[model samples]
Target chain A: SQTIHQWPATLVQPVGSPLSLECTVEGTSNPNLYWYRQAAGRGLQLLFYSVGIGQISSEVPQNLSASRPQDRQFILSSKKLLLSDSGFYLCAWGGPDYGYTFGSGTRLTVV
Target chain B: QKEVEQDPGPLSVPEGAIVSLNCTYSNSAFQYFMWYRQYSRKGPELLMYTYSSGNKEDGRFTAQVDKSSKYISLFIRDSQPSDSATYLCAMSVYAGGTSYGKLTFGQGTILTVHP
Candidate 1:
């Protein structure tokens, strides 16, 4: 079985602080990884996706960036956080099929 | 216009009643359609997936898609309180090149099933 892990489960940071959120996948190799932000009603918005190591495609331009350091490890980072950057961050791995398997998610609160 | 459109309903329904959710899309290139359920403050979970235009059924859920109409639906039978959550519709083009497995999601519909 394949599983995705994301952390710090929840975070509260002051505005302008640096941010790092990590996601990893187990039981699969060379899997497609994606980062999404879930707002209250806007649904899941794709932020970044990687097909392989060192390759990242951004869907929306924002204060965040993504990196794939290892085959199964993806990190979402920001040099400085903005108040609008607060939301539920989800990490997902694409399956052999069409759909995706998502992690528990990270609730980031930038105050 | 948005690529995908879904009613953000805080729909209230009694237990055992049938629940129907729907979404419309403006893009005709979408070949893979999916429905996901999300609990409060949690990540969305895949509930149903369909290819092109057709109907697929699981234990208690059914998914329908109409390519010509560019519409998709998810129906939950014998709704339970546990089913109370937000339902989101997502679609993607075929895997390859830049569009590989990238999904476009709707605004999601919130459903509350009461016991």
Candidate 2:
């Protein structure tokens, strides 16, 4: 079975602080990985997606960036956080059948 | 206008009642439609998906897509409290180059089925 993992599960960070959120997949190879942000009523917005290592496609232009260091490991980062950057962050892996399998998500509160 | 539009209903229904959730889209190129169920503070789960137009059913969930009207719907039969969650409507084209299989989502409708 394939599973996606994301952490820290929850975080409280101060403004201008650096941020790092990690996501990983198991039981699949060369799968498509994506970063999404879900706000209260805006639904899920695509942030970044990667087809392979070092191949990152950004969907939204903001303070956040993404990297694929390893085949199954994707990292979302920011040098300086903004108040608007607070939301639920989700990681997903795609397949032809089910569309996407999402991680539990990371709730980041920027104060 | 937003490519996809869904009524963000904080809908409350009694157990065993039928629930209907819906979304509309402006993109005629969109070929795949999906429904996802999301619990509070958790990620959304894929409930059902249909290609192009027509209906697909699984268990108590039925998904309908009308490409001509640019509308799609999700129907929950014998709705239970366990079925209470936010339902999101998503769609995508057949391919998107490097961004293939990406989905565009509606604002989502929140549902609560009480006893």
Candidate 3:
């Protein structure tokens, strides 16, 4: 079985602060990874996706970025956070069946 | 219009009642369909997945896909309060090139089953 772990379950940062969220998948290799954000009462919005190491695709232009340093490790980062960056951030891995296994998510609050 | 459309309903139903959720898509190449259940303030969980056109049943939940009509549906039988959550419909073309597993999701419908 495969499991995903994301850290700092909840984060509170001031505007212009740096942000980093990590996601690692156990028991899977070369999987498709994705970063998504959900605003209150809104649907999940795709932010970035990576097919392999050093390959990232941005779905929307924003102040956020994503990277896959390792095959099973994905990281979402921001040099300077903005108020609009606050939301529920989710990291997901695409399985062999093409089903997505999502992490518990990181709630970012920029105050 | 959005590539996919779903009713954002805060639908309420009693226990043991049947629940139905639906989505429509404009992409004709979508061959994979999925339904995800999300608890409040939590990540979405995979509830059911279907390929092409057909109906697949898993215990109390059934997923139906109509490729011709570009529609998909999820039915929950014997609904429970635990089943109360938002249901999202996602679709994708096959895995290849830039389209591989790049899912486009619907707005999601909120379902609440009362005990």
For all candidates in order, the CA lDDT equals: 0.92, 0.92, 0.91
Question: Each model's TM-score, in the order given?
Answer: 0.97, 0.97, 0.96
Off by over 4 Å in 1: B97-99
Residue lDDT tens for model 3, A1-111: 899998879999999999999999999888889999999888889899998899999999999999999999999999999999999999999842568889999999999
lDDT of 3 by residue, B9-102 (tens): 9899999999999999999988889999999878899999998999999999999999999999999999999999999999877766644477
Better of 2 and 3 by lDDT: 2
By DockQ, the better pick of 2 and 3 is 2
lDDT of 1 by residue, A46-105 (tens): 999998999999998899999999999999999999999999999998842557889999
Model 2: per-residue lDDT, tens digit, B1-115? 9999999988999999999999999999888899999998999999997988899999999999999999999999999999989999999876645546778999999999999
lDDT of 1 by residue, B80-103 (tens): 999999999999888665446778
| Docking quality (DockQ) for each candidate | 0.59, 0.64, 0.55
What is the Å distance of residue A18 in model 2 from its true position? 0.5
Off by over 4 Å in 3: A95-97, B97-99
What's the distance in Å from true for residue A99, model 2?
1.0
lDDT (C-alpha) at residue B14 in model 3: 99
Tens-place lDDT per residue, model 2, A1-111, is 989999999999999999999999999998899999998677999999998999999998999999999999999999999999999999999943458889999999999
